[model samples]
Target: MSDSFGFGQRFTPDEMASIRKSLRDEARFGSEFIGRLKRVAKRIPFAEDLLAAWVCTRDPSTPRRVKLTLLAALGYFVLPLDAIPDVMPLLGFTDDAAVIAAALAAVAGSITQQHRDKAKEMLADL
Candidate 1:
């Protein structure tokens, strides 16, 4: 897992690490954030993929760039406005899904079955 995510081209490992921690910390206590996600996870088409990203972020083996990319994608999921607003009923989550898809593609090899299993566990707990 030495390969860079290639998408997080702007941030160094230290910067990415900081950003990852910041986003994780924000979501850890962010009832509003996690609450919103939990409510939408069932309805969102790519929710599982995004959950994989979230789990991948916490993985010690995930590359820094991948972690940063995952954090950015997940962080975007919590925002009110992005490429498309998350309030448009059905189409709102499309952009978020696309972002996750792209992130997943960028780090194709990094997102392992382990991440998917962890994601499923967390989503079930949610």
Candidate 2:
């Protein structure tokens, strides 16, 4: 993707590579998120929040920065490894929750009621 952030900002090769990876990860985020969510839905209290963020991130009307932020958080959530491993029983998702919390705080208003409603519906069906 040669898409620019529209600020004329230039990225180093490594940064560009990371951007490409983020795009790829974001592209696959929805399915991967759902698969993992189904397995861990009973554990995480923020499933609805995560789903709402995903809904907003996929919305074309959402701002690029908000989508990027949500995608980065979602990317971290789906990763097999991170600052804390996801295999721990009770503490596994703290890092994921913190990342999601910060992302939601940064883009709080971007997640509209429609997105939240969709999230609720998705959660009900889960």
TM-score of each: 0.76, 0.83
Name the best candidate (by TM-score).
Answer: 2
lDDT for model 2, please: 0.82
Residue pairs in candidate 2 whose N, alpha carbon or C atoms collide under 3 angstroms: none
Candidate 2 deviant stretches above 4 angstroms:
1-16, 25-27
Tell me the tens digit of each residue's lDDT in model 1 across 25-121.
6546355556777989888877778778777877898877777677777776776668888778888888988877877888788889998998788
lDDT for 102 in candidate 2 is 87
Top candidate by lDDT? 2
Candidate 2 per-residue lDDT over residues 33-93, each given as its tens digit = 8899889887899999999998998899998767877887888898788888889987899
Backbone clashes under 3 angstroms, per model: 0, 0
Scored against the true structure, residue 42 in model 1 reaches a CA lDDT of 83
